[model samples]
Target: MSDFTTTRRSFAKGIGGTITLAALGSTASAQTAETWTTAETPTGNTLYDVERTANGVYAVGAGGIVLHRTDTGWERVLDGGPTGNGNSLYGADVTDDGERLWFVGASGAIGEMDVVSQSVDDHSAPDDVTNNFNDVAVTGVAGSANAYVAGDSGKVYYSFDDGATGTWDYTTPGSGSAVNAVDFYDARSGHIVDGNKSVFATDDGGTYDKIGLADANANFYAVDSDGADDVWIAGGGGMIHHWDGAQWTPADTGDASLRDIEVAGDDGLAVGGGGVVYGRDSDGWNRQSTPTGQNLKGVVRGGVDVAVGAGGTVIER
Candidate 1:
């Protein structure tokens, strides 16, 4: 593990108790104050993940659908996903340069897309391991970035050579529990959360060490890492956990299960069941009224906050 010399700080100390927006009543007032609005989509398939790149925002989901947000509106860029098999895409991340988008999904499917060209390269089932990949993180340049894939088989499959079959390797991070999500801060450092309620950190890109949430009752669904010290994890029971280098602090926002979270500097957003959208600002995390009741599965913070969920729902702020 590389040495981290920066002073650690905890932002959760200022987090107040949970505030349920529904209980606030006055739909008239809430509607006017709402900042999130539903956007039209090309498909009714459920979207599992969304990502922001230099080119634009991309969303992937069931039926191998890849939707791109253009200057005009949302457009279907890839209808059959990366494999042309229509496998449901679950997670995605952009290369450090923001020119390539890598996505992983059901049936061990893995693909890389040239954001500028809209062309895809299939690198699925690396090393003949066909376990369903739940999430993926790519670091470095577009064509040769390291790819780390979270597997449902409790292992993390990785390729230092842009997911080339021969360069692929695997590591078991948790106790045979499904690895749900993975995110990288750099080429060789990142974090992964599993169904076992464990969060593991890897500094050298291979070996992993358990970091926090050892006794968490809810299953961790997603993780976003700014660095070893600054990480955000969202999971069931509306719980979001943060690692501030020295310790981990968890706060419960409400009853809805939080499926995904993204943090950039001091701002962030978390989305999950029942169209729940929680925004994190200088004050800490708080619930925000949304326009849909559909369960949200994925969210991304780019030029704007975009979230996608069940019934082909897409909302933005």
Candidate 2:
């Protein structure tokens, strides 16, 4: 492990309420805009993963429902929406090619939706390998077609041919189970968290090796790689791990179950249960306050903009 140390700091946004985050993003431009609102058809449903594009903001949740937001307002894409099905969406992937819009959720629901055509068709996986995928990651390379989906039960599936089909390769890297999140730098090198505790990395993409960190039993939920060597992972009890080209070491953000995290440019944001938002910079960790108490499931960024997750809980930073 690299001998890097992590430091935690606190901040007060002076807006609505105070949130305690270990480290918060300071290098990125903080949002002075307000983009928080309750979803329509308020059936008391929860929003899982949220994504924004040049068009608008889209969030889907329980009950086979989809919600879209434009400059106008939020609207239900389904006729009656969340209409029954009781299915929960875990994650979404917007193709970087500006070609496809895909969504994945619990119960192996994957689709390629036609934006201009207003149609969505199922994307299939192998029989014995379908999973309640927690997240879908599009290979962030130009003209790349691979998208990987991860979830419970030590499951990890990917498609170099773009979620069409692939060899069923499975592995349990540790004693604690479930691969909650996965990210790839090229197609060959990446890392995944074992129930937010331990991390496993693969230099060859087809095979894997474990990098023992300073903390054990750290339940890490999410992982992201800026390059083959530059990677970050976040998880349970608020443990943050960064691979600084040499080794995987723990970056101190305290412990608090940081469920989801996003890194934009040099800045990053970590969100988790309890309306929590942690911002990171060269100095590391500051809390952003908002008038929310819902548990944030995920955080992502587009441009200098940021979006957070909670049940029907969406905030722009």
Best lDDT goes to which candidate?
1
Badly placed stretches (over 4 Å) of model 2 are 1-43, 78-86, 115-118, 128-130, 140-144, 165-176, 247-249, 303-306
TM-scores for all predictions: 0.89, 0.76
**TM-score: which candidate is best?**
1
RMSD of 2: 8.9
Residue 181 of model 1, lDDT score? 91
lDDT of 2 at 105: 71
lDDT of each: 0.80, 0.57
lDDT tens digits, residues 68-187, model 1? Answer: 999888999997777798898988888877888888898988989998899999998888888888998877877789989999999999999888769999999879999999877776
Cα lDDT, model 2, residue 208: 56
Give me candidate 2's TM-score against the actual structure.
0.76
Q: Candidate 2's C-alpha lDDT? A: 0.57
As for model 1, its CA RMSD to the true structure in angstroms is 5.7
Candidate 1 clashes between residue pairs 3 or more apart in a chain or in different chains: none
* Model 2: per-residue Cα lDDT at residue 127: 51
